[model samples]
Target: MHILILGAAGMVGRKLLARLAQDGQLGGTAVTRLTLHDVVAPEAPPVRVPVSLSASDFSAPGEAERLVAGRPDVIFHLAAIVSGEAEADFDKGYRINLDGTRQLFDAVRAIGEGYRPRLVFTSSIAVFGAPMPEPIGDEYLTAPLTSYGTQKAIGELLLSDYTRRGIFDGVGIRLPTICVRPGKPNKAASGFFSGIIREPLAGQEAVLPVSDSVRHWHASPRAAVGFLLHAATIDGARLGDRRNLTMPGVAVTVAEQIEALRRIAGDAVVARIRREPDPTIERIVAGWPRAFDARRATELGFTAEPDFETIIRAHIEDELGGRIAA
Candidate 1:
């Protein structure tokens, strides 16, 4: 099998690459070649399979065409402008998220007869807006309150329509906020969810932008990669007309996250979290979905960390080599 990964330089993308390289196969078939693309070239991993790396803007004219020319057996679309950045820069968000997605889909369709590949798109729970049910169900209508969410919702629609028309076998997974993200904090509005735990465990202070009672869905970085892989390999026939799925995740509040940190890393680490409310972030997060039913995804064999405690331990083991600051 040949595999193509967009946004290959990002955090989840990098982890997905490591998993693929380590296993050297997908869906029980050997991956003979891998293509990695992003705005900036990705560092080539030490994989036995032949690998190709490209740095280009897919939204730009002619670029998307070039990307799909190879007709990879599987394509994982993980590229998008993050929430805070998307909200701040409207044009860049729509251009990269909406226009770019259309460009890629069109390119695949233009390939003509009998050329369908399995396409896995990374969507977000941000696709659902406020006035949400406590545990948003699989049947909930997407009413995005933010530009990032709007783009992802539209992308989900496109994926469904294209799949229905047999252009490709597509699956869109609405991922939850990934906690204990290993890296410097980026501009994503949900960064604080991971920051509060990650920074404190590393003996650094982190700011909590939202209140203790503010609850949200979360999954570890490892679980995010698992969702991507499952989407790539799952039997699409069972999915029927609904090509998009809300992935399974644990729902916890800021206080619960802190308690989990305290349980695993001691009170000293928990003390590193300082409350500094940012109203803008709070407003953005308020519009985001706090929890999900995700029964559909769970039934389809996609899984996540059961609770915040397991999430924190996964971070410590995976990113910190199971060691924490004393």
Candidate 2:
């Protein structure tokens, strides 16, 4: 089978690529050809499959059209601006997140009759707004607070409509904040969640942007990839009119995270975290959902981290070669 991964150089994109490359398959489907696209071209996959790399902006006039010309068997759309960047730059956020998504949808719609490709989109829990009912369910209303959330919520609607029209089989996985992201921090307010754990494990100092009592939803990078794979393989007939589902995740407080750190690496690493709360971050995070029921995703067989300790260990194994030595 053929597969195309957009934003192929970003952190999640790279992890997905590495997972596919190492496994040499997705959901037991052998990938005969893989296409990687990003603003800057991505490196060739380490696998021996026929790999194509290209640099293409999703917002450019003809870019989306060109990217989908091959009509690969499956397409994983993982490109988007982070929450902080999107909130700070409204125009750039809409241009890429909204307009770019529309352009891709239009391109797929333009495909000839009987052309149906499996489209897997990576959305986020930001689709929900403040004053949220705790443990937001899959049926919860999507009243986004920020422009980034609005764009994603809008993307979900478009995907459902397009699939309804028989244009393509689409699945939108509303992802949780990925914990222990294996890279330098980005502009996302949730970056601190990963930063505090990832950096400290690397024997580096990291910042804590909110109070230790702050709690939120979380998933591991491995679980994120698993969601994509499941979305690609699952029977879309089971989705019916509701094409999007809130993903299962572990809910834990920042204090619990520090405790896990102390358990894993002792007091020295835990002390490396400095608490200097930023109200901007706190405000942004306050509106985000703390937990999700995710019953639909669970019923559909998507898995989640069992606990914070499991999440931290997955990060160590996947990102740090299974060693927390400082």
Pick out the ten consecutive residues of candidate 2 with the lowest summed lDDT. 317-326
* Residues 138-257 of candidate 1: C-alpha lDDT, one tens digit per residue: 999999999999999999999999999999999999999998899999989999999999999999999998899999999999999999999999999899999999999999988999
In the range 224-309, model 2's lDDT, one tens digit per residue, is: 98888889999988888899989999999999988988898799889889899899999999888898899989999999888999
lDDT of 2 at 267: 96
Q: Give candidate 2 misplaced runs (Cα > 4 Å).
A: none
lDDT of 2 at 128: 95
- Name every residue pair that clashes in candidate 1: none
Using lDDT, give the best candidate's number.
1
Q: Flag clash pairs in model 2.
A: none
Distance from true location, Cα of 94 in model 2, Å: 0.3
The whole-model C-alpha lDDT of candidate 2 against the native structure comes to 0.90
